[model samples]
Target: MHATTAIVTGKPGKARPRGGMTKKRPVDWLLLALVVVGAVLVIAPFYLVLVNSFKSPVDYATSGPLALPETLDFGGIIKFWERVNFPEKVWNSILIAGVVSVLAVVISMLNAFAIGIGRIRGRSWIVLLFLMANLLPQEALLYPLYFMFKSVGLYDNVWAVIIVFTVIQAAFGTYLLSSVYGTFPKEILEAASLDGASRWQILWRVVFPISRPTLSVLLIFFFIWTWNEFLIPLTFLASNANQTVPVAISVLQGDRLMDVTTTSASALLGIIPTLIFFLIFQRTLTRGITAGAVK
Candidate 1:
């Protein structure tokens, strides 16, 4: 019997055992090559900055931008970091982005929750208003805010920038959260209501906790947006002390110094937080950013 079984198992025409694994489809290497090429193109600028940031200024100017540095250089990095007071600039950006993120999330959550739950008489109209408001370009809104902030003596203050960005993000945030909440199982919310949970309690305890991933994505987006906000901060904040990293870097690179290597180092430093945020919370971002981005 054992010999017969072995002969059957080894038969040339017999189907092979899967060993508990699903059969994989043949890989499309052409598609893979295209994707790899696209990824390289997207990452190329940052890669160039990283490599060239280490080259000496003279070497950088003399050599091809794409070539690897012949000798490592730290002097430019140190000088730029100190001259720009990079740490202070970083701190300023963090403070602005942090505050903006929190405020935007809170405002967005409340507005979305109200709109999503349909507790209002004109819910659709309210949502439409928000969507319309969001559609207005920043440039269209900028001058009015510039005038308002200037009138209130908040024009040069970081708070001015913070307020503008928070409000802008809040509109989008509301749209995002409302879409998510609209899909909630009605029975669960009904059950919570039957259990004597107040609307506020339901929102804070049940909905908020459940939507942490979404909120996290919003926060990350807000941080990145405000962190790299250049034109607003540049126009509003004229002083070196008030400038965020992007504005600071731009000002330092004006035609006077013309120091390419140090400017690259500064830019690299400015973007470190953005990179770190992406690396750490990439999975979380995927869940919310995509949904929010689409509509």
Candidate 2:
């Protein structure tokens, strides 16, 4: 008789014959296939962008987007770079995104502290109002903002875009941070109070340190969102010198007839800095997300 060995199933008195093979579940395969498909969908665009960026116009025309380039061509990239005055546009984007990220996070923290920790009357309603404000379409506010900024002589300036995004971003940040802060441990707050720590001291020294991970997540998000903003920046930053990367690209695309390769080069250039920024902060993002998930 063939000997049957037992396999422990991590339960008391629960064992299966080692000789028995576990049947592969159709559902597991299906889920894996779905994940692979999702990954492909997400990666395909970046692949296309990278591939075409190195192709010359002639090569692109001869061989479609999917085909490998005949040679590494820098001409298209160089042309796009010089045509748009790319460094200035990049600087504009970095400045706007960086400033907005910091300001928005600070504003959100203060707002969340009031609504969440303070437990003020009608705090729920206030949070709901902020959420409603976030839902308000930017299109509806465009003309009023335009008029206001123009009157204040802030139109066609990077600061105009910065200030606009700071408020807009802060609305969502406040809503999110409030929810996070609402669940903060009362014991900790009480202990801090007992220690004679002022509200200001508790906020800066205690709450801020504990919430740093979430704040870092918010900061990265705000920067990326502000970087990618197109409509408001295009409208407010009318001058070429003041335009962000997205605005510069749109302007170039609209004003000139760009071949596939050059257009791809422009897109690649536009996204590279943002990609680098994300890479640098990717560890922080991962740690923050993991930390936030734990209690």
Candidate 3:
């Protein structure tokens, strides 16, 4: 009363513009429509596989892939599982892919450390060599690798696949990681050096830890690549006991007459494990890729 106070009658709230709600630009709506269309296109094949996989052969033939299953059929799945010795194939794939991923990443990191951080002489030439290795098709080396493995009594062994893929994958990884490590922040290295960190200590505790996200992406890629490798694994892992999942799928079709439903069921089984793996590591892959975009 003494200071001429002003009374506020209405509740405080955000003021709307003179017009009603803002209208979205036409470009925005177009982009949204395009995204929806792209998503549908990408998802359609998986939808067909899933629907057909659960249908009986007769149901699949009658209604086609676009139609929903008349009844859920475990028959196709069970038949493929038993005939292919699916468990053994899965175990073999896991063993090979796991080993290759670790070995390839480690080998790549060491090579990258030397080339990028150590500043080895002729580093450009070395990188170029690795790049060339990637350009060479797998088919080109198949015969040589086949003979080499066969001569050493490692043929038909999971180790053969593991060893060959480790080298192949590491070549590309080294080419990639060298470029990444080359751009390492000098300030961080200087700080670590001032802290009395030896090169080995820095590699393990400082550099490796900082580079973990990129390495995780590489590890995931290596695992998936090795798991899906068909020709090399098919040739190297001859026995049913040693064959990987992809080899098993091919072998299944070659061994018997598979109806469309059975084939779809096998394809579905083959994809589920890899899809689960990708989903689990998806966040890590995204983070790794985006990490470089920011500071």
> Against the true structure, whose TM-score is highest?
2
RMSD for all candidates, in order, please.
4.1, 3.0, 5.0
Model 2 lDDT tens row, 186-241: 99999999999999999999999999999999999999999999999999988889
Q: What does candidate 3's lDDT look like per residue over 1-295, in tens digits?
A: 3123323434444545557867789999999999999999999989988888899988887898899987898788988999898888888988999999999999999999989988999999999999999899888998999889879999988899999999999999999999998999888888999999998887998889989888998999999999999999988877889999998888777755888788888899999989998999999999988875663
Candidate 2 colliding pairs, count:
0
* Order by lDDT, highest first: 2, 3, 1
lDDT of 2: 0.93
Cα deviation in Å at residue 236, candidate 1? 1.5
Poorly placed runs, candidate 1 (over 4 Å) = 1-27, 286-295
Clashing pairs in 3: none
Q: Candidate 1 lDDT (Cα, whole model)? A: 0.84
Poorly placed runs, candidate 2 (over 4 Å):
1-22
Query: Which candidate number has the best lDDT?
Result: 2
Q: In terms of TM-score, which candidate is stronger, 1 or 3? A: 3
lDDT string, candidate 1, 20-137, tens digits: 6655545766778889999999999998888878989789878968889999997668878888798888888989999999999999999888889856788778878888878887
Q: What is each predicted model's overall lDDT from 0 to 1?
A: 0.84, 0.93, 0.89
RMSD of 1: 4.1
